[model samples]
Target: MKKLLISLTAAGILAGCSASDSGNGQEGPPETEVKTEEDPVTTDYLQERFYEGMDYDAYAVEIQTWVDKGQASISDTVKIEGQEDVSADIIQVADGFLAVANDSKEITFIKPFASPEDAKEYLKKNL
Candidate 1:
C-alpha cells in the first residue's frame, strides 16, 4: 500500500511536470490582425478581345449611329452583308445592319470587306 501511494504520487508529479502551463500566460487578447489586400491576377483570364477590335463596317455603322442620334452630316451607309439579303434590317439605323452569325464563328469579322463591291474589286478579292 505504501509503495502504491508513493508510485501514484510520483506518477502525478511526473504528469504535472510534463504538462505545459504557458497557455494561461497573460498574453493580452490576440493582436488585432490587419488583413493584406490580394493582388489581381496577371494572366490566365479570358477577355473580350474580339469585342475590343472594332471591325471597319462596325465602325462605319457606329459613326452613322452617332450621327443619326443628333446630327445628319455623317453619310456613312452602314451596310451589312450577310448570308442572305437582309438589307432592310441590316442597313437601317438600329442594328447597324449588323449581327453575329455562323460565318463570323468560322472566320473572324475581317473575313472580307463588307462592301457589295467585294466581287468587283480589282485586288482579286473573294466575293
Candidate 2:
C-alpha cells in the first residue's frame, strides 16, 4: 500500500509540472508574441495606398463620415456638398476616386489618383 501511494504521488507531481511548463523546458506561463498599432497585422488592408503617409483606414473613415452626414453621395454623378461636381458615381479608394455606375453591365476599373482633390478635379474636367 505504501509503494502504491508513493507511485501515485510521484505521477501526480510529474503531471502537474508538465502542465505548467513552457515548451522551452522552463516552468511558468508560455511566452506570447505581442504586436503594436504600427505592426502590419494591426493596419491590415490599410497598408496599401496611403495618403501623405496616412493609412487607408483613416482616409476611408473620413470619406464615410462625409457620406453618413449626407455631405457625399455616389450615383451617375457624385455630388459633394462643398466639392465640385463629379463626372460619375465615385467610390472612395485608398488611392483616389473610382467611377462606378450600375447602368453598364460590364466591369470597369478606373485609374485611381493619389489625392481626393485630384479625383474631384478629374471629374470637373473630364466627366
Candidate 3:
C-alpha cells in the first residue's frame, strides 16, 4: 500500500545517509595533516665573569681577524685541568689560550699563559 511504499523509500534514504558513506566517496577515516617543528639554537656563556659585555657578532669578527692574521688557530677541542674535556675552538693569544664553546660561542676558559709548561705551573700554583 502507500504506507509500505513510503516506509521503503524512507528506509532507502536512511541507508544512503549512513555513516559508512562518506560524501567524498573515500573509504575509512579522513587523513589529517601533520606539522613538525625544529629544535631552537641556544647560546650560553661558560665563564660569564670574563664576558666584557661585547657584542657577540663583533667578537666573532675580531676572532676571525686573528685567524686571518695568523695570530690564532682554531682547534677542535681543549682539555682543562680539574674539568671535563670541552668541545671548543681554541684561540691562542700572546699570553694564553681562550677556550670558546662551539655551539654557544662563549669563552669557557681563559688561561693567561703562553705554553703548556706555563699552564701546568699556573694550575699547580692556583688550583
Candidate 4:
C-alpha cells in the first residue's frame, strides 16, 4: 500500500513534467490487462481399457490334485497341540463327513463341514 501510494505520487509528479507531443501530455507506462481464471473441465475418466484376466483356478486345482496323490513324498514330522506328533494320514470318509480332534479323546465327527451351504444340505438330507 505504501509502494502504491508512492507510485501514484511519482506518476502524478512525472505526468506534470513529461514532454507533450501536441501540447496534450501523455506519460507513464501503459495500463496492464487484468487476467481472470477460466471455468476448468474435469479430466478424470470412469474406466480404464488396458487390462486382461487370467484363470488361476486351473493352476490351483492342478497343484492341489498333485499334492493329494499318494505318490507325493510324505513328510516325517507332524505337529499337534498337547499331544504326540503323528504322521499325517489321509483317511477317506463319506462326503461332508470330516474327522477333527477333540483334546485327548479319539478323533470324533466335527458337526458342520467347512462349507455352511454343504453342511446345511447334508443336515437337511441326513438329520
Best by TM-score: 3
Worst 10 residues of 1 by lDDT: 41-50
TM-score of each: 0.17, 0.26, 0.33, 0.16
Question: lDDT value for candidate 4?
Answer: 0.30
Error of 2 at 84 (Å): 16
Select the stronger candidate by lDDT from 2 and 4.
Answer: 2
lDDT of 2 at 117: 65
> What clash pairs does model 3 have?
none
Whichever of 3 and 4 has more lDDT, that candidate is 3
The better-scoring model by lDDT among 1 and 3 is: 3
How many residue pairs of model 2 clash at the backbone?
0
Tell me the number of clashing residue pairs for each predicted model.
1, 0, 0, 0
Candidate 1 stretches with Cα past 4 Å from truth are 1-64, 69-82, 85-108, 111-124
Candidate RMSDs in Å, in order, are 23.2, 15.0, 19.6, 32.1
Q: What is the lDDT of residue 68 in candidate 4?
A: 59
* Worst window of 10 by summed lDDT in candidate 2: 40-49
lDDT of 2 by residue, 59-110 (tens): 4454455456444334234454433422234554332355432212322224
True-structure RMSD for candidate 2: 15.0
lDDT of 3 at 52: 39
After superposition, which runs of candidate 4 have C-alpha atoms over 4 Å from their true positions?
1-79, 85-92, 102-109, 115-127
Q: Per-residue lDDT tens digits of candidate 3, residues 15-118?
A: 88884576657543222212122321111221322343333444566556545655555543444445453334445544355545422444433444345455
